[model samples]
Target: MNFSIARRRMVERQVQGQGVKDPRVIEAMLQIPRHLFVEEAFQSQAYGDFSLPIGDRQTISQPSTVGVMTEALLLQGGERVLEIGTGSGYQAAILSRIAGKVYTLERIALLARRARRVIDSLGCVNVNIRVTDGTQGWDEEAPFDAIIVTAGAPSVPDQYRDQLAIGGRLVIPVGNRGDQVLMRITKVAEGQFTEERLIDCRFVPLIGRHGWQEGES
Candidate 1:
């Protein structure tokens, strides 16, 4: 099957049809080869609307979910983005296309290694992947322009809020492990934030200090 054509259809039918209006996000989704981020056994279904396993007990978020989460960031260009959960590096690849830089964190070493190989193979140099607890929120690179958490957290992490630059946005899914609500939070000013709920989503548990503990999933 022609993955490019399938990718286009995915954008039209699954992503855009679901109400993701940002042209940049749509174009990024169109350009990235998501199949390369998953196992070859599942590559044929990579362009489908649903999420697929990427090993290490993790999954790539559904295409529409990635679209909605990315659109919520409203990235114009040249912004530093922190992606909490680099499973498959698919979301990071998308971010790399739309942002100036991407710092992604994944706890599972195997997953991180696999994702790095795939990302490097695709020449996504803007994405920097690290193996660490994502709940800490990459304190060394704090005050980011945007932060996207690809896992479900029980609540918003205070560290994430403190790391956002004024006018920065953080898009995350918050709720139980099996269900979640996507939230977009903007740091308008010091100690002042505005939040908007986007859509319902489901993601693996964000296991770390500020999220679900390990083995909880």
Candidate 2:
């Protein structure tokens, strides 16, 4: 019943306990009420160590996953970020606390609308949610300081790498539709990047050009 306390416990246990060392990531997990992002029926499980459905077959990534991905970005402060899957907009809400701005894209309009309402209600005005094919990467808003893809893709999308600013970090899951390896790619120079595998993960298929087609999933 006490959501605030539950949230802190989540950060201390599911997040920080998982070895996510970034203070900003931990603080964001502490500040945001995860319960608000899920449907009313599932609100009680918001702070649990698992993902919850947010409709449209999408999920709010588990707390530890969110922490790991966010920490991988290494956000110090005031950097522009692009989130490839808005889902419940919970990740965007978390990023809004540490990033200068968050541009999130969701392929499903209904999900986008729902995420927008929740994000707006939280007064996370720095998060911009748009309904679009995320695999394309927001070219008009190119050169993001950090890029995070919440879904699993068959391979790393070229558009994402092309749009990243030099020295920027991109955290994404790359593999089959049912399984993936979380990867961190840092753009060191034009057409040059270093990759690190963080963890094995499973996420919804990233459906779009340069990702998995609808039929493939």
Candidate 3:
């Protein structure tokens, strides 16, 4: 399979065709090798317009979804970005290409380890992956320029809002476990944010203290 050709087709169709206009996001999508993030068995379908499981019941989101979410962050380079749910580290790699640094969290240890290995192999030195409950948000690295949550949550977690720098943007999917609306929140001032619904989407439940319990449906 000609992965480079497949990648360009993905960015042009699945990503740009989905209404993602950010040039940086488009370039990142083209540059990152999506096939390397998925398991060998699924590599052939990595650039397809759909999600792929990456073990531990988590999935690497579709390329278009990643592009849309990354675009909503409104990154202008040299910004610290926080990513909730590292899954396969594909999203973080894309952010690393555009942001100054990326701090990504994954609750599943095995998944985190796997994602870390792949990210390291790509030499994304600015990307940091930690095994922790992403719902709580990374307080030690508070005031992120942008925050992106890959999992679906019942509501926007307060920690995410509090940890966001004023003027920072947060893109998250909020709603029921089976369905959600993609939301773009911008912190305009202290304790003040403006929310915009971007699109309807779906994702696995975000499981953590501030999210759905492990046993909940």
Provide TM-scores for the models: 0.97, 0.98, 0.99
Ranking by TM-score: 3, 2, 1
List model 3 lDDT by residue over 10-42, tens digit each. 999999999999999999999899999999999
Give the winner by lDDT: 1 or 2. 2
lDDT of 1 by residue, 85-169 (tens): 9988999999998999999999999999998898898888999888999999899888899999999999999999999999999
- What overall lDDT, based on C-alpha atoms, would model 3 receive against the true structure? 0.95
Which should have the higher lDDT, number 2 or number 3? Answer: 3
CA lDDT, every prediction? 0.92, 0.93, 0.95
Taking all chains together, the TM-score of candidate 3 against the true structure is 0.99
Per-residue alpha-carbon lDDT of candidate 2 for residues 39-158, written as tens digits (9 for 90 to 100): 999988999999988887889999999999999999999999999999998999999999999999999999999989988998999998889899999999989999999999999989
Residue 69 C-alpha lDDT in model 1: 88
Let me know the TM-score candidate 2 reaches against the reference structure. 0.98
